[model samples]
Target chain A: MSAEEWEKVLWKTQSYPDNHIPARYFLASLRKNPNFRPYTYWPLVLASCAITQHLATIYIFLAVFVRLKECSLDPRILVWITVACFIGGYLAWELLNCSRSDTARRNANGTKTLKSSILVFLALMALSPVLKTLTAATSSDSIWALSAFLFMLNALLADYSPAKLGGQVRERLTSVLSMNAAISSSVVLGSRLSDGLAVFALILFSVQAFALFPMLRQRLQATLTIFQALLTLLLSLLSICLTASLSATVSCIYAATLVAVTFVAPGILVWAQKYKNEIRGPWDVAVPKVN
Target chain B: MDPLSIAMITDFFHPNVGGVENHIFMLSANLLRKGHKVIVITHSHDPDRVGIRWMLPSLKVYYLPYPTIASSATLPNYFTFLPYFRTIILREHITLIHAHASLSPLGQEGILHAHLMGVRTVFTDHSLFGFEDAASILTNKLLEAALKNVDAVICVSHIGRENTVLRGQLFEKTDEDPSTVAVSGNVFVIPNALVADQFKPSQIPDVSQPSSKPLCVTIVVISRLAYRKGIDLLVAAAPRICSAFPNVKFVIGGTGPKLNELLQMREKHLLQDRIELLGPVRHSDVRDVLVRGSIFLNTSLTESFGIAILEAACAGLYVVSTRVGGVPEILPEDMISFANPEEDDVFRAMSEAITIVSQGKHDPWNAHKRVKGFYDWFQVAERTEKVYESVIKSDQRDLWTRIRRTMELGPFAGLIYVVILIVNCVFFLILEWSIPREDLHFVWMHWNRDYFIELSQKEARKTSFI
Candidate 1:
């Protein structure tokens, strides 16, 4: 058809149907995957490392529970190890802070972190006895169920996106919910312990695992890339070993999950890239130009 | 060509008034004029008004008592409307189901049920949706499912067609060649039309009579006061417009959630006397509202075939609209002053429009003539009829061929499509068994020859009056 023949004019009716598109003019304006961003393997693997660290934290908490049940780990030794690690972590954090250009702001942040840590430690110590009896009437079956549910919630709701890798607190409700559930499960489980010292140890361990650990991990990943990767590998291996000490079946499951998340998931994502044909064109709602 | 018994399904219709409602009503009326039987199916907004009512002798509207959930859209209970919709189809002897608006649950459901009943379906998309947001994502997915088996998809503009194709995932892909982009053959671009006779330049006062006092250049804005309409931009630019031109005023119409913000802005600027908020105007009185202003300002952030601007042009008002979505496709540069959807840009465009109107260089009567010649409902109806014809012809293909076409979407989507098809087929069979087609009575009120003669005579009288 000629250009004039294709021109849609209201005054003069044409011989062709209203919807007739000449072969040459069909989809002349279509643009496919104009803004598509392809994924790289290493970045995806790096992002999934957050999930590995989160799982390792859960593993350490469970290992502490198993040791407490067997009476194999002394509360006194646990307290001394926790205090020494806290002091060492604090010193390393301060040294890292000193490298920043804003010394005054770094010092303020250091003071705030120290003050908050001391306050949390004292609060957990004082609340241990109360927590020991708080869930006494609740059945052991219910407590175990609740703990499982909370742990699953933490795993599902955890933010695994690289956008949160900037050390900025992008705390979604899901993140807060997951953290609270993890702490509350520890408290409920701690209540089942016979001695207040054991309860105190459990609560303190949870505070460090659920709260302080994520911040340090995020900071490490943001500031030191190679060290973060090494830490992820070390944590994954330690968690696997601890799970194996608990039960062979549990260890096998943990290893399988680790492989699926870190390796299999990225492979699937890369395989699916061929189908990513998101077409954009002038027909899209114009993103309004703002001056 | 045989006249089709068509059912126009939507969640928006009379008792509610907006662009989509007006478009459906006008299109139905014009289709009826062309000797087609048209019935509208919409969710009832008013409790007192629930059953069928005749809007015209031929145009019957059935307001089903389905509770509206949000934004006048019915609750999207997938299969709840099937039996009732099936009953209506049988009673109306509907050969074609023409659904309006993608967001309407009734529209989507009607299309699904119509396809199961072996009737042709055409969906007209009236708005543009983004691909980024969660709500848009879910809506696009649902649209894709609904449109998977639809015979044809009609869009009001080329951009709208593109958006619909993308949202519906209606592109055909070849395995060997990834670069080739072929859109689905069912999509069509058909711009909305205006009732030119209703909105005529003769409604305006004679331009030859010069007034002793200079007329205040009133800029009219007629749109639902929604955030997407860019009412915030209008509110922000109002003060600047008022301060820049001494003899400038605004006449705003339509009611919505953003009314209070507009009132607050008016009070803060204390331009109560300058800006006239008409609250809402009936569709019949839109031309009256347009004639009161020298310029019509459309600060809509997005539009798909701005029918209000076309109406304004038909009523002899110079238009100033945001160059977003399909707004840029509606008019020539001389008829409208384009602006970005921002405060400064809109303010500048309004000021420029005021200057141009005041200069009296371009004749508004010419704009009216051009718009009238460009958009006529009869032409729109004829084009729409051609689409119906083509789809009805293609609907003759065997069931296996249709199923294969749907399965080509993707493996997972194909599985879902097959399941939906099976469920729909079962439900349709149950409905047929329970309510036998012989039990349903077909209404032939529109088939009367006198009605057609009277309609043509009325149309002729309207043209002669104009």
Candidate 2:
């Protein structure tokens, strides 16, 4: 094609067909992978730790339930252990907050947190007897099926992202649904237990697992990187050991999931980057410059 | 050459006032004047009227009784429209199926069904969609599916062509070999046109006449008050513009959900006297509104083609538009004052345009002549006719090539498309068996020979200089 013929001016009529694509100008404006930000192995692995922590929490919850069912651990002892862990987590969170420069801006509200925690404990204690008999009339088969479905809902709906982008109503809804499902699952499981004390210990452990634990873990992960990775490893080991004490098959599945989530998924993502071809050009809708 | 019968399918048509609707109406009318039998298929707009209605002597519209989804788009039922669409195709003897607007499900489905029936298809994209959002992703995937086997794809601007190719995933990427990055083979850049005669400057007040008293420069904005139109920028820039040029006034037209926010902004700035919000002017009154202003301001954050700017220019008004999408490609540098889609930039550009117009530095008459010569519906129809001719002349793809192209979309999408095509074939058989070809009568129509003779004479005059 002649140099003069290659111009894309619209004012003058040309002999070529309107859909005639000249080879020189064909894909001339295409820009491949314009917004591709390179991903490293470590950051992706760190992000995947959120999934690992969630799965580990689920495994630990199931393990505690099984142990309670077998009466392998005392209900009072289990309650004491959960209380000690909650207080320790609170102190560690406060220490982390004190070390941070934004503590004043955050307005650490220790008294409010304490008050809410005490209120929750008292409420759970009062509700245990009711929860124990709540699903007694329902058959064991239906109880197991309902609890299983709720647990699945919790797992599917949990927010696993590291950064909490503010005010996404859909994300907030999913997170709320996940919490509600987990709490409902715990309530149903508590009703399955014969002892009211066992029900209380199970509810308290669930409150720690579903509600306070995620906030503490998120804080730790945001502030201390090494501590977050170490905590992930520690939780994985604990979940595996606990699951093994119950069933070998469950422990094996947990180990396989841990390896797959922590190592295989990130590897797949990094590998798939090779096939990423997002074309951007002058034709794209320009991002408006905000004042 | 024998004139081709054409079917224009879209959900947007008359009763809906927008750029795409006007483009379709004008193009179809021009095609009819050129002696081609034209029929438009769109969803029913009013309950009182639904079947075949003739808008012009040669132009007919078939409003399919289908439920509308969001924003006047029909609900996407992949195979539901095939029987009726095929009947229209057969009855009208339509050789070409021209689908408008990527977002319109009726248009996309028309293209797909036309292709399945072995009829040539052309798709025209009118808007720009980004790839980052989920909605765009889904829409793009659907576009990819529809355009995979289409004979030709037409975009309204060069940038629009690029966007269509990208969304359709019609390019290949290779670092080692630039030649391997196969460009979209059939994508075309055909800029949208306006009815230049209708937008003549003589319809309203002339911008060139200097007043004895200090005259307030009227800056007109006519668009749907939507977020994508950059109404927020207009809201932010209006007060600053009013303050910067004390003799400047604003006349805004069109209505949308964002009109309340603009009203609130106007009240907060206390410039109700300076700003006149004339909500939703009819399409016929657009030129009347445009000639009342010395300058036209468009604050659209994204646009495929700024047809409003062209109409404003045709009305002999200087244009100030955001330098996003295909807005920059529509007018010459002298006729337009370009700004980034920012409030401050819009305010600055508006102030600059006001100064330029007040100083009599730009000639509105020359701008009007330039726009009139640049965009004409007859020219658009002729170009579209060429596309149709080329598509009809091209060799038909065998079944395997069609299936392979459809399967290239992705595993799941490929599965869905394959199933759709299979069902489409079965449905085609069912249609053929139930509704025998002899039973469907061809709608006999004739065109005014004098009209074609006049159009041919005009065409000859247009090409005489070339």
Candidate 3:
């Protein structure tokens, strides 16, 4: 619209010609749709791997639980298997941590401390009996309800990504909800068992799977090559298979799920995200200084 | 021509007080006065005023119950809001969707649905965002996506426009036809408007005259005590400024997470004698606070319009503010003193403003006239109405006359989306075929949407509009 046209009608129609485009005007100056970057294959795949690995680990843990429940597997044998895997994973992680001379780049700082782990172990040990008998007085239904609530809390609170990672806190919190439920379920089951040794074994497994494994997974991502990751995944799958032999149907189901999880889940998630294509515009509030 | 019907979209609105909320209220009220049909779409906070409640004659507000994950922003449940938003538009016959604030999920969701429904989308940026930081980057990306098909962007100042263009990466490498994604010229600079009549300075006789003792000058620092507000600078400068000038006393107001820090400073400096912490005075009482002071101190790191400064100016207080964001453009040099967002600079500026008042360089009468001349809701309403017309006309020129008119559409909207979707699907299919869903364990949904909806809806409909 022309200056005359705009001026003539602060409220009424003007004398300016129709189709009189204002040159270099504010609206015209805006690039209608801008700054959209297409996602490449490799980065998308890498991002998916974070989800993939998490699902695979969850499956492996479920497979272990199934084996323990059905096969009547020797507690000593399962403990040994878990210890060997932990030691190997630890060695691999330490080497990776050492190789990355730039400590700043490495995410595995202060987190993998033996002291912290020991302290956590002591704390958990101290709390387990209290945790076991503490809720015993409550009705079974309420206990169930409370356990479910605690699991949800754990899921909400768990940080999947370190501060350096790209995912939002909310996203990571979502990822851990399943893990929280599984661990809490195991704890409830452990308390139900008559054997204290069985309870201890289950508790140790829960700690490894929930608390310790996520940190290891992050380190593995940071430190390992594709070949090494594949190799580790293969080994983890083998252990899952061995563990599965102890429990037939449930373990078989879990093992199959692990394969599907490692391959399909990430790809599906990426696909969904790509299709949705979140469009953000100026309507969003500007993050202001609190000052 | 008839006044345009506008759907003002914001996450925050009346009952919730903030810059964006106040902006929407004032803008809508003024637009309504100009005979425009203005309805607001925001998430419900109050109960009784939930869903559709008429705020004024010809001004209706539709409150949507979207889950707020943090602060007041909806969870960006994009497609979830489309149906209701569409219904609201159809019923109200909303010609334009004018969204305020760039980081709000509800605002972005409104724009997306508005675009899908073939309505004109105009976004107003109320604050500046930096290029750096993860949160800002994500926000910028979301803003970029939202702006992809928007008609035009309204910035409060030239600086805000520049920041938006740069941070949004609106300009990048051009296509073969030299077609850019978007141009910077689409940014309209419309400064904030104030109800000038409401801010008319009270004629208190003997207020500005020389007293028996040296004139007691009050420096007002009224804002949330937060890092962004540069409250630390105020906390640091309060003691020095007060100690340097015994005649001057500090009246600091507003509260935030940094209130404890301010209190600590007050306690440490023994400033109970010199400084007064008013502790979060109401918006209605802002003028009462301002009129008590000779100089208004705004030690902010960033500001969109510095509406508080404008309000202070309207109250005839000399604005001593940091020259950051849109603040530098708000007032002329004589009526205000520009300071860097630092303790030394703020202190210096405060001293300078005091000196200028002492020397009678700035007449209170002249300051009032300048303020009245600069900002008024009527003028703002007119300019905003012009924006509405121009934006509507622009949309008429750009929007497809037919649903499948590819000629008017660009690559980003049509072909690229199809290709990207196909490619992603192909990859997903391959993964699925190679892998298996039966083998994959499904994770249950975390939060119950239905439960939250019922609760929020009940709260929205039940609460009184206080």
Candidate 4:
């Protein structure tokens, strides 16, 4: 007749009606957001920096392509700038690897890096003529459209997480596809250039920006947040500067995207935390604890 | 109270042996015994067993022509079931619709269109689902929509009731406090029951005792070899138990995707001599398998109502089970052993149970008698009849109220269900116009239980006389 008389057990026959809701015990075990941890605005913005960096790389590649097409920059100078970037990036990598305990392994890895870089450099030099004519029969409009589509795929499929295994590259299927897509897009776009040297410079630069830079960025994000923020700022500014004189519309779009990614998206996510509700109770499939 | 015609609708029924299927059959048979007219509606099975059929005790079944998509469940299409449901409800003069299971599309659709025939609706949710996984979230929303205007909701256990209340959104803002929500007054807890006669303890003693082992204890496990059944815990604990107690053996019955793991464990531990695997046990032979052992081990990670556990206890096996949903409420502490769903805890519980069985501290006959007094199918039917009486007396929800309540599903799903509700009404109107009720055939010859008994007796006597 009263709330105290009702028990949660089903064995004993009770005086109350079957549908009678126990005023005190109904849904007493129901829990909301039992394991929820609201994401902070700063950390989310920091995470979004990965995506922003990828977008900036895409815009920078486009700016470089445009400059080469108009003959505003020499292919030899672009090639020299790429070699300087490779050396600077390698020095930064060595500085990061100094914390590792193995000195002998680092010496061996140094030789291996030198050998692979030399091999890739000479290979590009040898294949530039073939790469230049790879898509000669295709229309310039088709090339532009194809490269745009491939770049979008590259940006969407690129791995944005910080390296979990201390900068060792995880060959995820989508990430490999993204690398392939970026390389192929640059190859077709380089076909539009006037000479084999321009195509060689573009191929080398694409390898650095799309392949090597993402690996270094992942390591930087893992090790130093300040470096990641500084790199994101540098890339966004350089991308805007590279596109400003060529097209004002492109520069405005790039600036708006960087602002939205760094500030607006995280703020929206932080505000949306109020709506989080995850129901947990005894009915959930118990995760069995076993050896 | 006058007899009421009830239709038991579900996607799972006879020919598909499962918890839902058996629960429907048993509840329908018990209700028929209580002088209420009962019928079952389900989807057609493969190769055979279609159209109208009769079960024992004159229970009628109508298998609608719809192929099952997965696990004997039909794809949920809101409009396609209305025609068949309308005709059946009209011909059978079903006063109330009792649908079973949350994932059964046939049951949910029956509840959706039951109102068009002016019949009340009752849903019996037999399983528990969490609100986390994508499949659970989708099915919970669908359940919420179907139960928006249901007259009564029944769950099998205390935890199951709470689970279904949240999953089906069976709550309403209180009259005194409009902001705070309270559980709706229609949800009930009617525990599933078994026929104690079927699970009677073994009459003959162990005739073929392995003479090599002086004293041996056979631990029995009868469940689908699946992760949800906590087979990993069994596989992990079985070898340890074999090593710890050289006199102990295992008899595992049933087969599934995880059967290979159990097989590999047996082979790896060199427990091939101690463990016996019987694949795909028939329900009729469950008692035979259970009676061969002294202890029944259940390692289910999640269960709503463990009817199998009760059946084991009735078969006089000392029960050792994971302290999961509703398992604790089935038997008292002294009768059954409990474990956390952990490998070490299960090994500990098994050790205790084996010691108890070896010392003859647990009486199989006493356990059997106690479980018999605990649950019975007739008692479940009597309780379900009370639910039906209350539902019949209660006022049915009107269309406006139903639409208003349904809009609480969500911003998007709410509108979608509202559209389903409106379109269902429009389709009902079309059916009423196209096939007028005056031209349809109404079932005048109802199945009478007394007449059926008399006729069967006569046939039996004639066969014996011949």
Clash statistics: count for each candidate:
1, 0, 36, 0
Arranged by DockQ with the best first, the candidates are 4, 2, 1, 3
Which stretches of candidate 2 lie above 4 Å from their native place? A1-6, A14-17, A20-29, A100-116, A156-176, B115-118, B169-181, B202-214, B398-401, B410-412, B445-466
Cα RMSD (Å) per model?
A: 4.9, 5.9, 15.5, 2.6
lDDT value, residue B320 of candidate 2: 95
- lDDT string for model 4 (A1-291, tens) is 655587787666778888878768877878899889999999999999999999999899999999999999999999999999999999998888788648999999999999999999999999999999989999999998999899989999999988874546677999999999999999999999999999999999999999999988888888778888999999999999999999999899999999998999999999999988999888888888988
Which residue pairs show backbone clashes in model 2?
none
All candidates: DockQ: 0.26, 0.37, 0.02, 0.80
Better-scoring candidate (lDDT), 1 or 4: 4
Q: Candidate 3: which stretches are off by over 4 Å?
A: A1-291, B171-184, B205-214, B395-466
TM-scores, in order shown?
0.86, 0.89, 0.56, 0.96
Which number leads on TM-score? Answer: 4
- The digit string of per-residue lDDT tens for model 2 on A1-291 reads 344574455655666666666667655767779778978888999988988998899889989998998899899999999999999998887786675446554565776787899999999999899999998899989988998899889888888765432322243788889988999999998888879999999999999999778767766766567887898999999999998978999899999999899999999999988888676766566666656
Off by over 4 Å in 1: A2-16, A22-26, A99-119, A158-174, A241-244, A289-291, B75-93, B113-120, B132-138, B141-152, B169-187, B201-215, B267-273, B342-344, B389-395, B419-466
lDDT of 3 by residue, B193-252 (tens): 777666656555355563423278888889988878877777778888878988888898
Q: Give the distance in Å from residue A212's predicted Cα in candidate 4 to where it truly belongs.
A: 0.9
Stretch of 10 with least lDDT, candidate 4 chain B: B205-214
| Per-residue lDDT of A186 in model 2 | 93
Per-residue lDDT over B135-196 for candidate 4, one digit per residue giving the tens place of the 0 to 100 score: 98899989989988899999999999999988888888989999998888889999988888
TM-score of 1: 0.86
Itemize residue pairs with steric clashes in candidate 1: A283-B159
